[model samples]
Target: MGTLRDLQFALQLKIEELRQRDTLIDELELELDTKDELIRRLQEELDRYRTTVSLPGPSVVSAAASAQIEDKQRAARQTVISEPFIPDAATLAMGSHKSCDKNQKSSRLIKAAFLKNDLLNLNEEEVRAIAACMYHTTINQGCFVLQEGSIGDRAYVLEEGRLDVTKDGQKMRSVEPGDMFGELALLYDCTQTYSVSAQTDSKLWVIDRKSYQTVLMQCGLSHQAHSVELLRGLSFLQSMPEDVIMKLSDHMKECNYTDGSYIIRQGDTGDTFYIISKGQVTVTEKKPGREESIVLSELCERQWFGEKALWGDDIRTVNVIAVGEVTCLIIDRETFKDIIDGLVSDSCEEVQKSNASKIKPDEDPFLVSSTLSDFQIIDTLEVGEFGHIDLVQLKSNIKHIFAMRVLAKKLILHNSQREHIRREGRILMEAYSPFIVRLYKVFWDVEHLYFLTEACLGGDLSDLLKDKGNLDEYCTRFYTACVVEALAFLHCRGVVYRDVKPENVILDEHGYAKLIGSRCMKKVEVGKRTWTFCGTVGYMAPEIILNKGHSISADLWSLGVFVFELLSGGLPFDDCDQMKIPTTTIHGIDRIEFPEIISKDACALIHTLCRSNPLERLGSSRNGAKDIQKHEWFEGFNWDRLCNKTIPPPVIPKVQYPLESSACALYGEGSVKQCMNWDDF
Candidate 1:
């Protein structure tokens, strides 16, 4: 009986052990499933790259796909060049081996480089002199490390787990250990080039500029010793200064016509040069047997075409068609000329002799000219209870025309209110670009305060949004960047632009947009943490409407709504009163809804911008709207292409003077309080 019991006990122990093994397997499977889901999401973002094209020309491989192919080629080239780094066969034949202790020490060193951020504050000789600084932090799965629009200051080295880099919400790759990402932003000081999300719980080290500079000063580092390293290091050159790379990158443009597409035809005089970004295009000559199309080149990614006719004043060399989708970048002749001119001239280095003669400010050298001393009466454009704008001819033609905005006396009774108005004027002036009116002077006349700026002849963006049909992504990108840059500049100064609406955005002839004078006149309560609900109703972000503390992100939200109006030719959320009779009900409140028709990129951008949570709004996230700028929709824009230079202004067709009468109606009525402006102040 005892022997039988002992055998039974042993069987019971075996059964329990098997059960434990099964549970372990189940847990492992669950973990694998979680990891897979993270990978899939990352991959989904990568796939968003499909619609990306080289532009004008179509291609067999999408831009994202081509990038992958290039990466593989570069990787293979690296392996071949690095073969010399391996131990020699003679060493192996000698039976020499690395000790386990040595291997352990090496592993520790790698781990120290990969899993630490304490290095950020330390500028040690080793870290500082090494030309690459290592810093790391942990990231959870689904967290995006890098995003499109925000500028990048560092390049990351993946230490553990994986990451996915995406553009336009598409995943470009599953980057894993030993992979480096975000070098482009660091190299250029421009916005983040792509969005990066962790595919798993990740550990990463980022090499920042200071550390990198420190490393480059090393005496041991030389071009000959690190030729392969140099190439890898220079991968960051994709973000090189636009002037340095534009010509070479321009050479990468491929131009071709698919069967259905038109290549240039007769009598088109506009200047444009096309380079194929992808695919084969056919050229046809109409003489005899030549009538049939002949393929000049099977233009794939990186192939150059369309230069001979563009360089000189030549007409179309041959009629062309895209055999397939052709992707190409079309450089307008004017812009091309501008670039070539910049290259040939030393204008960037040569400042005018007149500029050097001016006295320099001991501090804040950016302060150019001082405010105007006096001004005579001018023709009033609009006078209201809040403020007024006047059309004024400055002292000289070189002075240009200026608009004067005066705050209403009633609104400035409170000393705090007067101070707030002054601050707001500065903020508003900074929040818009040169496309908008450029604020040149702000001061107080005897009876009136003045905010003066360059006048735009074309009128406000609100009118354009309403009158023009739906705006395309191309136009929206052009405007959004201008406004965002304006906002960024304003925010950096610690000024909050509480008011952002379509009515405030004025357009110039060159399609450049600007913030008009209305923002300067709005009433502002001093010492308040947040402004009152001041913006036009439909354009206000929910947070602002709720009187939550407004910030730079508020302007971003307004921009989203503004873009929606531009694209849809109407508002995203319509006025309830507009529909006298309601159709659908939400929480027993009847509502009307309309189908949306806009590019997916615009829609996504709007959705992000108009989020109810201010934290999630565009430019407020960890990475922000920089990612939005990098979307596939904005593929062809050379961001550096538009900075600090005068853009070809939007084409304003000849409209009879007094546009308000032609489009909707021209009428204005408002009252100013009894007290004079200076007295109220």
Candidate 2:
């Protein structure tokens, strides 16, 4: 009876333990199900992210669609919370620039500052538009406008009251009305080097970097469209390409004159052509002997004056006087020189050069005419996006070192660079300057195109910069002079060297700099525009990135960037995120601190060259490159030596190196053959 009772009790205990074990297993499975559901949701998100950010656009997006996209972008930006900047309603205000209640006086003050401001070389219209985007605000006397050593995102303009700039406990300068501060940080997104404190209760106007850029981009688009139509209606400019007209409009400065002001003096040198946009002007011409001028015509809205200037008259035949608070749009003569004449004849048959177009290739002793049998390929020097540069030498003489740029026909066709390839050949044939590399002969095989040219033994400026970091002012000036000369040669021929960067400029044994990488170059006829977006990413000019018509001034912009990099050992618009480079470049260089090594003169030249308005750049004057050559920075620079190749180069490079094997052809000159045909040889 005792054994039966104990077994029954033990069996009941075992049943209860089994039931508890089943309940625990069910709970564990439920937890795992929840985790798996979460994982599935996350996987969907990962799939969404796999789509590329750069979506292809088959057609231009409508303005309404652009607005919607902008709204979404703004919403996305708001999710990224920075510091607590809600000091006032205006300080951290979020919305479109148009939403802000702009202070006219404050905007006028900002515009005035921008006009004289070297960093922001924007024109009158652009300045006015950008200034209106600044929000009006006020701060207490004790508050700091900007804290030292912090990352600054907004620039401020004091409308009223006093402020002081201090660095490391030392007061530097007293801020005045209409003065823009903290712009360096805002433009370049750099750290503030000093602190700004309000000495008295201050009324201020401020614009964050984001808001300023948004407004700027919108303003540019609006202004460009408006200007294009305005230009098209003008009789003298009606035939120009729409894109060219848009570019011309960007360069056009808006000028306001009181009633009865002299817009142009009869005898004064006429470099600028003007189109009256808002009011009437009286045209007067002074005859050779007459002291008083005779009225030629009464010009009103849409009427233009000084049309002859662009076509190379170099003089204003008549005087223009403003009537009733007139506003006029003006373009300088040299800004678009002789556009119609760009396609003039003088192809390969026209150049042997030294004396130019008349000299035959067979007669010129320096010219090399040869067949395939005369040369042998030595080794490959460089492989590029479109081609590879090979070191080749003359067989019989064995000393002529040449860089044979071999391009695969298939690659060129694949990249759709056929026109570019042909244009390069034409340019190389026509171009004859000491700074430009000599193109000896062109060859073609079954699958490749070959350009036999001068060998630059010293490597490119990129390599030089690596070996010698941050070149000094003197060295920079000399190196840049070479590039300037090359630009002058190309620009004079109506070609724009779109890619002007350190990597594209190579040095020879004598340290003479010559432009290479002609892949990004094209002839943008005078007063014409090309919208092909080509060139180095970080070195592209604002107009080029905008896809607005660009010309020689584009090269000048890159030259400024080149100067900045040479002096600072980095680009002024460099960003960690590659996507932001174009955005930063479009914003201009108003905010970055120039390296301590750069001088005021160098800064001035850079500002002049890198102006947002390309037509207003330093070399866009009637004197062309001479204006840059005459800059204070190049005060004593001998341009003659640069052009004549008589200047002493800053660095000499070693030309000799061991070949891949045991033998290599060196260098020789003065060789010619009767046959120019490759097939016959």
Candidate 3:
């Protein structure tokens, strides 16, 4: 009996050991699955990079550069296929490799030289200490050193060999030995702007975010003092706080210009403000009807120019020439504006309070339909010449999606432009059509005017055309019918849509067309016409091009051009030289040669609608949109169903219930604000 009991116990022990082995096997399989998924994602990214880099065009990349790129692509593929760095079971369990102190002194030397340009004030001891904290590593050729959009933790100094740098899959430049890359990642915990890949076997020294921040903190006081000293001499920046000056310095870049180079030219759009850091510049103005430029002022180091552009139209009023080899610290328009806004917020507390009180219970009837406090801005969808279109949601219990159009009040307040804004608001409110983007409300604060309207997730027809090339006849007819109905509604209401093109037509989630852009919609009496040399280059009507009086007929001509562009992949009269478009437009539809691929019926209809004489245009006749609707090109089309959005659309954009980032321009988290004072609006 004792022997039998001992044997039973041994059997139980063996079963327990087998169960333990099975559990280990299950865990290992799960880990392997996870690694496999990671590898698949990496492979997809690599493929996309290869495809974008290999796109053929002389304009895109030189022949020699193209060959080099192809060779790199092959090397990368071979690396992936032959020796992919897959983590083994033991390595996975242990995590990443430990950092060693090998090659420390050499790394310190490389880092010092690499950071010399950016951190000019760093002493040898400070630079060595920063380098001592970095880890040294070597990678084989075709390895990705840093990837764009990846969470960046470290900056690298190349010790040996070359690396290629790319942004959005386009090669920007190459980094040679002793050069540093990925410094921006050290400044903030943001995604990398560019990808760095090893073009050959490379050695690098990398510093993590923690070490970089420590160094910056240690040097902060001196950096701030240096920035403030540089900025104090400038008149416009004199009132700025030390912290603001320090922040501005972070965004500023040093630019060098040779002698006699034009820093800025009169009548050109100014985009950057400059502070002379190391040389002299001369500001000049052209005397009326004179060839010679009169020197207004000669500016030396610490002096500035281009401040007026930040506050207004940004049109340069004077010419600036580099007197010698000049080095300037430059700040772009957006950065300057942000800095100014911050300073204004800090200094203008009293102004904001006064403006707050000025907001009475009663306001302009056309401007305020609902209080500005009721909506929350989600994200900026698009930036326009006059304003920005933002994705917004109602703050009420039932969340509603909407797009808020915000126009700068300063731009609208100009004497010549004020009427245009007023008219746009009025027309949008009065003109109600399903085919047009519906306006829910209009309001304004001290700094900006706002229009709340429906959000179109499918983007614009122009973007769609670019993606799909030219559309099929059925798809073109479906979209055209929607536009025709919208135009018919506008014309009958006595509103002339001066701008009519693919950009002006937006597509909803269901792919239905909606006409937007109220700026060019003007109300006119039946027989009268308005003369404005406005509208896009390629789509401009002959009457508008010739400066002849144009009314609703101009919209018809634009529509015809738009249809042709949609049917053919190219524009009817487009040229590389913009100067030639005006002459070509005035030469009229007779010069338009239709591609053989376009159907005969479509060609005939385009000719009828794009007639040079407004009276002879198909839609401009007594029958109006009815004549175009009955044309052979749109034969058997269901106009009523299309208008009602019951007809199945050719394309439907993928959308989530509230919204998706793909549908709009994504701003950083916390960049958008729900509440704004009158001054900040």
Candidate 4:
């Protein structure tokens, strides 16, 4: 019933949204009609002026005169596009082995030498920092820089002399000075497929995976924040999706200009965009026959120009010169073109609203209308300390199956969980979404309280993950999307879901994930906070763990942990070195090293959502879940299909029917003496 109601509500919302859009379109059309009149008058005036003044060429009027360009950049810094420490995982077969302290190398690095390694895509400052972290080492002649089939921990840059890369003792390639080798090992623990040996007494620079990824993540976070913040402030791109903005930011490069250096010169053919990030830059135009340029305007930090390059206007008409030392976030046209296709066109909710029956195929079974006596107990699904959840079948219709949560009233009273149980029951009864389990009905007797809900024969994500080890990106994405929908549904109703994890997600007959019953959710109004310090360790957000008042952002943080764990098979904050980990805060999440197995895109999403500051989390902005849904990682995802259940789930399970049994018979009305406290149910 809840699902049915929410679908109806969703339809109403979609209709309203479309109505608003239609009104906006009408208003825009009216504006265009006015603009057309102005254009006709201007054209007449232009024709008169052209005949009088003898214009340079024949007159032409283009239809594109009123169309606005997609004023955004298409370039990222070539030196550091993303996760520069590792190559594209799909391109390389990876292996890693740990090396002891004795195997670690140290040697002198030539400060004056220019490093020529394709593997390191970093600016001069990053390169220098990496160089400092790299210990100098020497390999004796004929010594293996790495042995075939041996696991390794560090990557090396050839500083002096040379080495041989061989397979089966046959030289396959030569390692020259400034070349990088064994770089993949720095990302993960894997065995070498081949061998590298010093052809001479060679000097090498070595940096481990931990050091390299840490430095890059630190720089990437700061750079990502600055670029994204700058992009977010621009007005023309304001309506662009957040994911596209993040994509542009990732591909954007930082360029520096000293006094009088030209960022973009007049009359030069250019397709690059720039955002002034530091100091000031003077925009100037060189008039015809003028020796010196006239200053048009000055742009400072957070200001941008040159977006015309993203469109067809590739020629720079004016020079942008640095007033002093100026920094810019720049992107080229090709990058913009590559990422612009990801722009979200329209909401598909309207299509869903058009469906005649906006309800799941499995509508409410007769059990919701029937009394308790019409259902017979099948078997106990889970035996908890409070009571047990049992599978049940409708006596009148054996085909209908459901799960009954039978909690002992006495136990709930003793545990002081009556209010929590009441809240959960109320939420489950009121909430509705395809991503959330539908609670059919609530009942109470002298001994136990019962919560009848939809039975998910496919089991839960926790069990599925246990059986499959860990999910691939495809499965992880699907599950994360489902969870996000569930959380969004709950959060929109002013509910703060503090418990968000795989164990709470169950897959239904169609294998689509749904958030089941939750006890930790609270009805927090807008801008309100809850002080309850409850959540699973490692999965809880920093605010919850610190007893800091929290809102829905905590759920988003846990969603980050859910995504990270599903992809990498472990919690981000969890590690063997417990002492080294801080207890008060998770502010050092930037320092956590993600396995190379997780894609850079996935890591980027996780980082944004898992920020220490709740307000800074990706979805915590005013746009909420739309920020996360439009993340670049979820590009091309069909949210409408997910809502409509038209998309097949990542996993499907064989359905199992529980046979009728008497296990729940012992927990009937006469079983307990203390049931007076649960009268509300």
Best by TM-score: 2
Candidate 1 residue runs with Cα over 4 Å from true position: 1-378, 396-399, 414-419, 428-436, 517-531, 576-596, 646-649, 653-680
Q: Which window of 10 residues has the lowest lDDT sum in candidate 3? A: 76-85
Q: In candidate 4, what are the lDDT values of residues 430-456, reduced to their tens digit?
A: 676778888877767776788788888
Show the colliding residue pairs in model 3: none
How accurate locally is residue 606 in candidate 4, as Cα lDDT from 0 to 100?
Answer: 93
RMSD for each of the candidates: 25.4, 20.7, 23.1, 28.0
Query: Residue 663 lDDT in model 1?
Result: 16
Cα lDDT tens digits, model 1, 1-681, are: 235644554465356456646755764664565455445434443454435524444664597697798665333212000001112344322212211222333344444443342212222333323323254456667766776655455777676888898989887788878666664333224346578988887766666543343233231122112322222233434453443342333222334455668666544444565555556666554444654555444444434345554467766655556667776656555544544454434243234312432433242122234334333323456544345566554332323445666654343532124545554565454434443456655665344556666666676665566567666666767776766665554443434564565566666645566665433232222111243334544555544432233455666767776777766776665444321111111111112233356776666667776665554565653233465567566677766666654555444534223212111211122222222232344
lDDT of candidate model 2 versus the reference: 0.70
The 10-residue segment with the lowest total lDDT in model 1: 77-86
Residue 253's C-alpha lDDT in candidate 4?
79
**lDDT by residue (tens digit), candidate 2, 1-681:** 325544554464356446645645654554564455345434543454456446547555686687697665333222111221112234323323355566566567778887876544567766666676777766666567776755567888888999999989899999998887876544433546788888987878887766665555555545566666678887766666554565566667778899999998876777788878788989888898988889888999877778777777776667788889898888777555533232232222124233563443442233345665566656657655445666776665556677887676665664456767676777887676778888877767555667878889898887778778889998899999999999987886678988888877899889999997476677876555555556766787887665444678999999999999998888888766443667688888776689878899999999999997787798974357889998999998888877777888888888894334324432222343332443332
- In model 2, the runs with Cα more than 4 Å from the true position are 1-251, 254-369, 657-681
Considering only N, C-alpha and C atoms within 3 Å, which residue pairs clash in candidate 2? 184-591, 339-526, 399-666, 399-667, 399-668, 400-667, 400-668
Please list the residue runs of candidate 3 whose C-alpha ends up more than 4 Å from where it truly belongs after superposition.
Answer: 1-370, 413-416, 659-681
lDDT of 2 at 43: 52
Q: Please give the lDDT score at residue 123 for candidate 4.
A: 56
Can you give the TM-score per candidate against the true fold?
A: 0.38, 0.53, 0.44, 0.47
User: Per-residue lDDT for 1-681 in model 3, tens only?
Assistant: 235644554465356446646755764664565455445435544554564556556664577787697665333212000111123345322222223475646765665664573422344545655665677667667767776756465778888889999989899999887787776444333446678888987777888755544443334333434555777777776776665665576557768899999999998997888888889999999978999999999999878898776676678989999988998888788766766675655346446534643543343243344455656656557655446677776555224677888776554443134555565666676556778897767666555677878888788787778788888888888888888988987886667887777778899888888898556677765544554445666677776554334678888988888889888867787776443555577677788888987899999998998887786688764457889989999888877777667999888888665543222222223323333232333
